[model samples]
Target: MTTASPADELALLTRLRRDLHRIPELDFDLPETLRYVCGELEALCDDVTARYGKDACTVFSPCKSSLCMFFDRKSEHATAVRSDMDALPVTEKSGAEYASCHQGHMHACGHDGHMAMVLGLAHHLAESFDELPRSVLLVFQPAEETTGGARFICESGVFERYGVDRIFGFHLWPDLAMGEVASRPGPLLAATSESTFDFHGKATHIAKAADGADSLEAGMRFVLDAYGYMAEQAKAEPCLLKFGLLQSGQARNVISSHTHIEGSLRTYSDTMTVTAKQHLAELAESRAAEAGCTCTVHFSEGYPPVVNDEALFDLARAALPDLHELPEPLLIGEDFAFYQRHLPGVFLLLGTGTGIPLHADTFDFDERILAAGLETYKKLVRIP
Candidate 1:
């Protein structure tokens, strides 16, 4: 099959992207969105196979709607490209003609564009199957916004089954201009963990403050001490300890007996991540004990820092054109880190021109950049 020109591919991809944008779905519940993606993959198969007389199979996730298109299944070595298939909970304010039709859910992170670019690669691969060097897999992943799907995908042993050599994924960065790409070899994104603390103490009237074990006081001390430790740690390495939720007394006249504190921990260094969790847990316990209160600390098993494999990074730098090496690590967390833990891979940042940041109500990208993304995916697939 002869592939369409760049212009034709972009035009078709624009339409498909809008169709996906109109029906944004949340994590792990993308029934209609899944159907649309599978339909597109199937359509590509029918069109390209009929024209070229080649064979291919597009596999749909049995439980969810994630789609994987395989070309050259018999080859010993395989290459995979991934695009997430989930939307954030942000409401759309972009006011585009193709803005999300679903309320309170939007593809504000540009996953719709990511999916489109990968599909463009799939279409190109289908059309040019004869010249392809090795087997290729296009993974349409689900629940990326919540950091919930990649783990499941890794656990499914899809990579080992196909003997995938190295994989590539990218996120659109509105912070940079169109046509620019930035990435590095290590810690492109941070590891993220959530910590929750609960304090218990005796309740007493405000006038009888001395009689109460003041759980609120204990919680306050814990926060301040934790923050101080975080500050000190930051002096040595990058770290973030954010306490976004805190609940204490119900009335002004009561010495609170119970308090709940929730916060997020992020760091580029794995050693720092482990140390910080230990420090916070110890501080919470000690402070609560001193205040004559009991405390419970729960740290979530969160995403690890996205550490690009060195060998894979060298391959990407040489293979991708006009690549910019990022100077510093981003504190943002990505579950794509989970994929790297299993096999060599590199996560890339494709610039989308300056605009409203990701996860915002007005988040959007320049459509022209979609071609760059498509080209990048195609290049990665061709990596030998």
Candidate 2:
């Protein structure tokens, strides 16, 4: 029950975090990331598998050796916890000596630290499996930054194979106080995904502009109109639409023939999200016809809204410190929402003590949050 002294825990977590931070990988297809994690999991869990693996192994393993022994011979049910792997495409500017050596890749989202703390939890739970009643499953998910890695794990029927009863997960938030873990009972995080709009038009040379259609302008109009339409939804409820990129125009003299508008959408309500998708299709076609070009709006759905299980969160509330209500529904997105959808679970946001928010190039967080996360999850598995 008592292990991983504060000092030892800090030292081990620091090493794990630094090691991972140095080699940040992008969402999905992270072979190196998987290799390193498998090595670590090999030492802790009695059984491990790359469950529903994509880039990295969404590593799954039992903390205990057998069911009867895991339940202390009484036996209740099995449970699982998830920690996301993979970093944002952002370039590292944290200036740490161990900062990502890979160009244009960074763990600005604090996922590196999250991975370590969850590993710490895995070690703690595995070592104490004799005392812990519920058999624990550690899901080291990948591609959470862009797609629904949690969904992949669930769809793989890993839970059915393991006989898991509930799930638990968490994220780092710079807005909250240090050592504080906060959550909402239901819809803790919104459903978010990418929707791309492409416009195709005939290219024209600088001298003969009349011979071609400017698809770039057509894409631009659709982008502008989409913002206006989406703005109304935000005013009504929590929603977000940002056209992050426009790639089409090649030269100053010639208008672009083919243009792509890439962006993201967020909504707490499935109805609103679906509505936004439908609006995207309508606007793309309407604006394209207006500009005498063909336009297509393609949405690469990311993840569903995080539906927190009330029972699981109640268990966390009993175990965690400084539990509080979220200020509001977060517009930011996450793949953890995928886990909440499959099983009754809770996704917490551990306070990063306020500074630069996640996904920023300059993002940094207090390392001490690692201890808070470790203690919180360890207690979550042990007490309940």
Question: How high is each candidate's TM-score?
Answer: 0.93, 0.79
Model 1 regions lying over 4 Å from their true place: 47-63
**For model 1, what is the alpha-carbon lDDT of residue 353?**
84
Taken over the whole model, the C-alpha lDDT of each candidate is 0.86, 0.75
Per lDDT, the best of the predicted structures is 1
Which ten contiguous residues of candidate 1 have the minimum total lDDT? 56-65
**lDDT over C-alpha atoms for residue 38 of model 1:** 89
Residues 210-317 of candidate 1 have per-residue lDDT tens digits of 899899999999999999999999998878898999999889999999999999999987799889999899999899999899999998988988999999899888
